[model samples]
Target: MVAKKREWRSGRRSVATKLVQMTRHLVVCEGTETEPRYFGGMKDALGPANGRKIAVVVRGSGRHTLDLFEHAEELCRIAPDPYNHVWLIFDKDDFPSNEFDLVERKCGEVSSSSCTFHALYSNPCFEIWPLLHLRYTTAPMDASSCQKGLVDALKREFNVEYRKNMDGLFSLVDSRRQDAISNVDKLDKHHKSIGNDRPSTMNPSTRVGDIFEELGPYLDKGD
Candidate 1:
């Protein structure tokens, strides 16, 4: 990941200096390689804090489904400074429906005044997110199909092959972020229209855009 330098500044030097509190975020991902690499790229893109107003920490636990959510909760509890927001990222790849649904439910129950928890899940697989940057579809896909779609889309759009742990993956798709977010909204509406509310049953669906929406201000603009 390429690092960028950023400067923090207050409006102006005044007789009375104002203190700015940094907003902290903790993102725990289930996949130890792919998810971590993508978010690590995000952190690098946001650049060095340099005592900035936002601080983001990304971690990957080699756990699945509910276990990943529990790990996130535990990490939040032990952090020196309580996180303002905690996001758990996981995929619904062959996980039992009950186990998948429980994590989303648990996120709602564990939120408090100090910290808010959000479940950012991808049905089938996380590859759906990158694929959305290239095209939009409402077709249901399993893990294999989702990855195949990503491979085709990457080759078609970027002339590159998709790899699970590809370095700088975030930068590769950063330019079409708005397109992905728009597709996510459409997919969400499609699921709702069909009366599909459960994450496990919502094939071809992903809430990954929720994290992007929350961290929009801190993200680097793409050309």
Candidate 2:
């Protein structure tokens, strides 16, 4: 028996709806000034394709390690969909080591199935990231020493004094950003080699370069 073919109405064709996916990053930092400025520069410098595809939004949470982590986690839970990358950029600056460990563990536990938290922590101080752009340093410093070193490095390299905030700080360091990333890798490796991989103990290590690499395509190539 031959089956009859169904008749087509006209020449019209059906099309499937396409869902566009956009990548957005929500950043919460412990600093009130510089972190926002730095990430803002990155967002502003995004190239066209990246600007359309990704977003790097930063907020200053003014919280310590665990508090900052919780703030980022809370924001991730409340933010609308497509804001999947939630990062807490905090320093281990004299905060209790237990708090640092707790923050790290909580951030680690968040899976990507839902919005997740990224702990972009710098041991000692956040200023260590900019200092890495100037030179390779594996020196273990306390918060005071870290601040002093950063101030001296900034003065020597860029002729700018270390203020609590610097306007366009990321752009200032953009030319040598790759160098910073490389140096940070070396620092991280050094820490791991010495078995100081944990947060409070990873003195002089910064996760800033890792975050920068994630958002690099969005930023313009600066000379």
Best by TM-score: 1
**Deviation (Å) of 86 in candidate 1:** 0.9
Write one digit per residue (lDDT tens) for candidate 2, span 1-223. 9965544455443655576677788888898888898887777777564546776678987888878877777777677665767778888877889998678688878756756667788888888888888888888888778778878888898898887677878888888988988898888789889899687888888887777656775564431
Question: Where is model 2 poorest over a 10-residue stretch in terms of lDDT?
Answer: 4-13
Q: Which candidate's lDDT is highest?
A: 1
Query: What lDDT would each prediction earn against the true structure?
Result: 0.86, 0.79
- TM-score of every candidate relative to the true structure: 0.89, 0.86
lDDT of 2: 0.79
Tens digit per residue, CA lDDT, model 1, 1-223: 8754333354544356778888888989998899999998888887655138678888989898889988987898789888988988999998899999898889899888878899899999899988898899999989999999999999988899888899988999988999999998888899999999899888998888888776676775421
Total clashes for model 2: 1
Which 10-residue span in candidate 1 carries the lowest summed lDDT? 5-14
